[model samples]
Target: MRPDPHFLRGGQGGFGLVAAMFVIIVVAGAVAAMARMSETQNATSRMAIQQARAYQAARAGIEWGIHRALAGESCSDTFTLEGFAVAVQCDTGAAVSLPEEGRSPRFVSLRASAQYASPGSPDHVYRQLSAVVEKDD
Candidate 1:
């Protein structure tokens, strides 16, 4: 006996239903991936800003140390700024590094470092910077 035409028509629609479901799943996955990418980009930008701030803070420490060194400050001294502590060290002769001859006329070198409490962590972040300054001589 031949099968009913209506039963055969019902079977034909099954392929189209499965294909539609697959397309919907793929679109949802694509959207989820884009959201994750956006979050990562935002995190990168925040890290860059933090690094720039750290660099600036380190520079400030260097400048302060150089000023004190030019005035004949001793080594192992500390300078404080915005809850950060800067340690200064000075040396002379071969022990100390001076600017290249005829470069900037600076005879003394100063090294400064700053330590800050890490954000949302038990650790800390420290940065060091150096500069060469000219003596009154």
Candidate 2:
């Protein structure tokens, strides 16, 4: 039996086409995965920045409260730091209650509540911090 000229020349032309398609598919998938990972990393960095801003805002609120308590001034307003805002309460009402053993007579409790926008959203993110400021006597 004599072989056909086309088959004798090469029967693997379609195989090469199929292999090329497979390689293209794999490369496309890898590119997509890398894009997703890059987006995730950028989002994480943004969140870290927002968290740092909120913490600084909270610290500012604490300082403001301490100053108000020491000077006998009112400390019941929202204070802004950078782009973050905080609510301060520096009175005897929500004072930091100490355990019976380690109570100090010259201590004042400072409470601060901070609210800022989420890194990728318009919704707010809230944080609370409390400290006991000892008198400078």
TM-score of each: 0.63, 0.76
Over 4 Å off, model 1: 1-10, 74-86, 92-106, 114-127
Q: List the residue pairs that clash in candidate 1.
A: none
Give the TM-score (vs. native) of candidate 1. Answer: 0.63
Query: Mind sharing the TM-score for model 2?
Result: 0.76
Best prediction by lDDT: 2
Clashes of each: 0, 0
How does residue 92 of candidate 1 score in lDDT? 42
lDDT of each model, Cα atoms only?
0.69, 0.76
Worst 10 residues of 1 by lDDT: 93-102
Per-residue lDDT of candidate 2, residues 38-57 (tens digit)? 99999888777777777778
